[model samples]
Target: MKKKKFLLIVLSLLVLFAGFTLTKSFLVSSKQPAPVPTSVVINEEKAIQNFSKALTYKTISFQEREKFDLKEFDKFIAFLKDSYPNVHEKLDLEMVNDYGLVFKWIGSQSNKKPIGLTSHYDVVPVLSGTESNWENDPFSGAIKDGFIWGRGTLDDKIGVIGILEAAEYLLTEGFTPSRDIYFMFGFDEEIGGDLGAKAIAEKLKQRGIQFDFVLDEGGAIVENMVPGVEQPVGVVGISEKGSATATLSIIGSGGHSSQPKDRTNIGRIASAISKLEETQFDGKLRGPGNDLFEFVAPEMNFGMKYVFANKLLFKPIIEQILLKEPATAALIRTTIAPTIFQAGEQYNALPEEASAIINLRLMPGDSLEDVKEFIVNTIDDGEITVTVTGTEASSISSTEGPQFEAIQQAARNVYNDSIIAPYLMFAGSDAKHYDSISDNTYRFLPVQISSDDLNRMHGTNEHISIKNYINAIKFYIEIMKVTNQQ
Candidate 1:
């Protein structure tokens, strides 16, 4: 009788587990994007040629303001005028802060709020020694092996040229938009956009101009990064991680080489840093992280779907999986990178002061104050002083809104079969500055790039495929057509 009772209980538990698993496998999908065909014809050869020429200008954004080449910027502007005569003749162009280019394509409906498309023309300075590593000269803008090889090819001159190409084509087709469209090209985005986008946003804000939505570069069509989604997934950044720098420092006696106290300043600082690194902030899969899985789970295989679909019940398990990989891990929590460590000049002498700078990419839920608290608490050392400074994460944009849908629809139109989902941007971009003036600011370049190509964005051998460039132009044209129709 006792054995029978135990067997009955076990059977009941197994049945309950089976029921839960069965229900979890069938996941609910987030959004079903209807097919929208684009008939816009891209002058492929000319588009590639213009991008190649734009790359040769070397509109490099240097940290020091004096290093900016105004002559090159002027030449790029002239090139834009020479290439897109219709855009120059039709749109009212205004130069903000001398070099920041703003073009307004006035629409028939003046009352409708304007949509701003922004991208930076400037590229990061290539490391001195690494320039030789490029197959073609970094500044040559050589079109070789089906790629426009150069610095600005991917980091964003494509955006500037792509937008113009689309607008120019639309003008040639005699298509007048129902809503006003603005193109803002920033020159100083590589450093911080202080004098470029910041100035543009401020000038527009002061003039009482508000944007319906703004699009800038952030996420791209990533392959193999998102698990279970076989087709390339286009990630549109609805919000970005906050960038913060925390300097942990300690000042103590500069001791002699012969004898010293048990714990020197350098040693103490090192220990604190070790503790902070080892005791990293607990990774939590909520906000954008959770939302990302929510969007992708339905498209996942049966097993993966079963795990993510039951997110509420198995959140800990999901977070554990995401935390295992560095790239996926960044999507969930704040990242800590110890960049600079300074202690001693000579080998023998114990330095008086020691400091280390930890750069942190903060999650939307984590604030600057919250990050400081975590570091202080983690280090748990009274001697070490921690100072944190950076801008907070921008407000989360709604994925359910028309603004995001327009972006998703545009990418879907170009890359017909790719899965379009919204995720938080891990890097900083000029889009963050426009948050105040626009109802929603989205970051998507609409170009399909591989993981290797992603690494080359701010690194050496940066290039964009001729196919991707033309597709980007088509995507921009599709975006204009999809949105603003009465």
Candidate 2:
């Protein structure tokens, strides 16, 4: 009788523990509030009109950059002043690097560090004959069938106009932030931002002003961006891959084609190139990949959820599957592609020297020295020489911090149905310039875009939906609220 009583007591304790665990899980999941309040209304027509008018200016960044008619940039600035009178009156604006514009909105309090929101005004030069691909003139800023078409519609002008609209609206509504806000607009981001964002970052550094968080243009919303996710995914870039160029050269004895030695200059260089391609850098899921899964895992289907939920157990298999697709492959590993090859000048004579240039995108944990060593060890050719030069990848920002969560929550408020996940940006951006002075740098373009829209960004037929322009403005407003709440 006593033994039966002890068994009943043990079973009761086990049941109680199970109930507690389930209740805890439920509470944790339910604690997060609904992403956005439905009460806030957006003026879609006005936002689209402003975005369309902003795109009409021909502020293309040229590589050689012949004296750009500063008059046009000046006109663009004046147009902003006229269009957003509230923003102009409320925010203190300063011009950096001749054309770069920075606006500071002093907050109700100044104890916390400021947050920066940045975008570039300049667009890439259109190729001479590619204008035919455009549905309308690239600079016309045509609004037709609920779309605003033009260059800079998607690249970055959307961000510039969107933030201004939010600020204008907030100022008119008598909303003030707890922390200071800065809107930084760079003029030459398309041409590497040397005279624009870089100069501004340097100036800020001199002033000893460090930002709590800096948000810039990088990734966007697109369908099928990830292989398995059905919803249109919005990727926020926490870090960007560094770009480097590696040069391989081999010098050998010149001889007649018929009497060429077994290992000539061309053969040695070609062999080295082949070796490098065959032996790529190691592939593993880490950094931004982990952050991406954390955000999307809750919304994933059963099968994807299982894989993502137990990532430590399924990492190798997940990586193998991701490697099969080129687009997905890039996310998990560094990439290498040969861009230039130079060899023989004549048809019959063997060239004295041959060289090849390889472009590499460095992952977060990898460095230029690591790349050089990998090339030398893999090729193992004594006569062939390899040289590498470029910037190493930037440091990864924390995903757990309040800054990241604030950005994610703001994105969710603007894009309620879409998932906001952090990932590494394959392309470089102006945000990289501010990494030295900021604790958290995030890259996100607050616009819903299709995959084809990405091609049109620096290409032909660049455009954005009227709905997306309004959403971009809404996102900025939500970000302001989220940032201040923390």
Candidate 3:
């Protein structure tokens, strides 16, 4: 009788556990359905034509500084004034550092904190030899085959032109916000936003201005980026990875290659790098990575959903699965890339010094000093001199509350079919500069694009579909309407 009672108790416990697991799986998706844009009507052909014309200006940001097309930038500024006469006429416009633009639309309620929408007008160069690879002259801004082909169309000009298109439409319709709205455009974001966004932030700081939120370009609507979720996920970047370069240098006794030591400088440096690659940062699916799965797990299939919903018990398995792809792997940890390796110039000579530069994208909690220590400890070689320098990751913006909700609602109004979620950005953007002057910052461009199109952002044949561009304009209109209501 005692043994039979014990067996019955065990069966009851198993049943309770299964029931709890099933309950959590069903409750995984807290995402409410996004509202559709029922009343927004935009001039589709005119919006497309305006974007195509904006792409023609070669306002490229070359690292060398001298290669900048100031003339084209001048023309682009003029184009903005001409294209959106209503905006230029009504909003208070100011120029910063010659090329940057700050346009403020005064709100009815002066006491309410202002909000900002920013994007860089500058674009990366069409790498010299690959210009011919484009389907059209990258600067020509050709509209053909249902796509607008050009350099800036995807990398950023979309943000500038899209925002302006919406604002112009709203102004023409005589719609004004209850709270102030600022449109900031930076010219140097392609290199580092120092001259443009950094300067703009400082100017705002001196004026005693603080924003409720600032939106800039970073994430996009991606198809098949996440597994098991059939709808395109619109990722709004709540934070971005920090970038740093760690140099591993070694100095040993000079010797001929013929009579090399067991552990020469070259060998030591190579070993250090090998160890770095072999033992990467301990990958943990926590913080933003965990939150992302939490948001999307409900949309995943039964097998994947079961694993993610019971994350505490199944974390190890989830981490292993995420680590399988480099892209997803980057979402979890500080990534290391061996960008530059330098050693002896001559083939025959093995002089004294050897070095390698590893570029790292830091996680939010990682301090630069701690990263340096982690590298030295991992390599465990006294001869290897590791020097580290890079920016720390941006502070994690709030994923909860009205700021994010406004963004989601705006996006959903246009692309109701896509699943919108907050995510951490792998790349840096001008959004980082606004951290101090705003209550919050969000990075997303309401554009429906594929991974193949994403690759073309800084590569050849860059373009955006006409349908996507039209939807982008409409999305902006909705964002302004919804957020201004807040």
List TM-score per model, in order.
Answer: 0.97, 0.91, 0.97
Instruction: Give per-residue lDDT, candidate 2, residue 253.
Output: 80
Q: Which candidate, 2 or 3, has the higher lDDT?
A: 3
Better of 1 and 2 by TM-score: 1
Q: For each of the candidates, give the backbone clash count.
A: 0, 0, 0
Local distance difference test values of all predictions, in order: 0.88, 0.84, 0.89
**What TM-score quantifies how close candidate 1 is to the native fold?**
0.97
lDDT string for model 3 (161-240, tens) is 99999999999899999899999999999899899999999999999999989999989999998888888999999889
lDDT string for model 1 (52-159, tens) is 898899798999989988899999989999999999999999898888999999988979888999999999998988977998988888998888899888889989
Candidate 2 local lDDT, 1-486, one digit each (tens): 999999999999999965764443333321123577424576767777788888889888888878576778988999999999988888898889779998999988877899999999998888999888778999999999988889888888988998899898888788999999989999999888989999999988998879999999988877776655677788889999999999999887887898888888988888888888888887888888767876776666656765666677679998898777766677888888899999998888999999999999988988899999999999998788899998878778877788877877787787776667889998889999999989989999988788888888888888888888888888899899889888
Which ranges of candidate 2 are over 4 A from the true structure?
1-33
Q: Judged by lDDT against the true structure, how good is candidate 2?
A: 0.84
Candidate 3: 10-residue stretch with minimal lDDT? 29-38
Q: Could you tell me how far off, in angstroms, the CA of residue 212 lies in candidate 2 after the best superposition?
A: 1.1
The candidate that achieves the highest TM-score relative to the unseen native structure? 3
Per-residue lDDT, model 3, residue 281, is 93
